[model samples]
Target: MRRTQLRRWIVGAVAIAVSVLVFLVPFAFILITASKTTQGASLLGFSLPDKWVLWDNIVTVLSDRNGLLVRAFVNSIVLTVASVTIMVVLSAMVGYILSRRQSRWNGVITFFVLAGLIVPPAVVPTIWVLQRLGLFKTLPGLVLIEATFGLSFCILLFRAFVATIPRELDEAAVIDGAGPIRLFFRVVLPLLKPVIVTSIVVQSVAVFNDFANPLYFLPGDQNATVQLTLYNYAGGMAANQYNLLFADILLITIPPLIMYIFFNRQIVAGMTSGAVKG
Candidate 1:
């Protein structure tokens, strides 16, 4: 039995190693392709380049006359930051109230939130509503759209985590003449660290990589986001510089890659910490 378990572990490790290679190989090709000359890149040579064009390509992409790539990058950051901030606050507040205070409508609220998990967004209707409200084609409109999508998930996480926090703290603080605001911010919020960290990781990745919302709501050359910037890689006059295009792709992908590497463990812990006896 011990030998069998050991063999299973070995097989699992080997499978994981191979999976990593499969996932990383394309990215590896991107780096090599990005550094190579146009001829070398086109030849599919998977070795060091004789003439490095890395810096030149970077400058060209960055300094494009249209300034679309850089503008898109900045827009993505704005969308991600604003969306995440609103999501965290709204979720935490709603979660706290639902978990901490007793209410007759709690079940209805929970049902609604769970239903959102399965609901495919009605995009055309959403756009029409936004337009009616005069929120079309604007940064604030996009931010609100992201926050709305994130609301249910954030609230779910917050409630699950808050349930694990001892209710005695609230009672104790109240006995000491503390108000609800003080009790939550000064006492309870600090204890929700694990779950908050988890939400941050999950929501951040979603908002950063969000392509559909940006495409639908903020569609324009000037408002293009990072994911949209990949269109420049098309195999035509626009996609002439495959090397530079691959390099720009590499640049756009790096920040999220670094974040996941550093915070993946925390993300998992936060998501699950409130699940079981939290």
Candidate 2:
């Protein structure tokens, strides 16, 4: 018993050490490189700068192209907030109905929702549909696209979480003359706080970091997102300003990273809570 416990403790310690290095090394490189000059950044090795210019790099990135980075930041915020809000509410409602209802159509809807996980989106067709709706090259179009693409996954998450919730509470609410909307908002949603936070954190990160959807559905410099701003700093035919690029990369990465750090516990709990019950 002592030998087995000792071995397990050793393995756990090694695993933790390895995990920290794997995640932090690259981030350390980014932070160090972002503090260097263009010439220094080009080295791209893990070395502290001769002269710390982190603030200068930040200023350059923020002030570049007459504040294009700021605009992209605003666009990303709008897209993330709108898409996440819609995804959470819609997915939760749909998941509740699907979990509670019993019918053949329920299986069909469930299949479609799960299908989103397996099937890759058709970009050209999506663009064509957006154009037909006169929503192409627009922020709202991109928001809808992000929301729709994310809906299935969110629904699946919410469905699993909802299944864990006792039906008795829902019944109790209904018996008290609470309508569906009231039952969900007053009785169900409060219990869903953990999963809701998980969904928001997960979906917000995905939507904010998404590069392809905005590129395909909402094309144009004016509609650029935070991810697109990286292109503004370094791209084909453009002189690669590695320092500025790293600075911008670090700046854009902070929000989602902070979110994950803060909500890490809720995300884990929410994902695991449904497993035992369902």
Query: Model 1 compared with the native: what TM-score?
Result: 0.90
Residue 121 in candidate 2 has what lDDT?
A: 97
Residues 1-278 of candidate 1: C-alpha lDDT, one tens digit per residue: 99999999999999999977887888888888888877777777678888988888877777775777889889988988899989988899899999987888999999999887879888899899999999989889999999999999999999999999888889999999999889888898888888788787788889988889988998888888888887776566765667877878888888788888999898888888888885
Predicted structure 2, TM vs. truth = 0.96
Clashes, model 1: 1
Show pairs that collide, candidate 2.
none
Q: Candidate 2's residue-wise lDDT over 1-278, tens digit each?
A: 99999999999999999988998888888899899988888777788999789999999989988898899999999999999999999999999999888888998998899898889999999989999999999999999999999999889888999998999998899899999889999999999998999999999999999999998887777898999888866787545578888899999999999998999999998888888678
After superposition, which runs of candidate 1 have C-alpha atoms over 4 Å from their true positions? 1-5, 8-12, 42-50
Whole-model Cα lDDT of every candidate shown, in order: 0.86, 0.91
Q: What is the C-alpha RMSD of each candidate to the true structure, in Å?
A: 2.3, 1.3
Give the number of the best model, judged by lDDT.
2
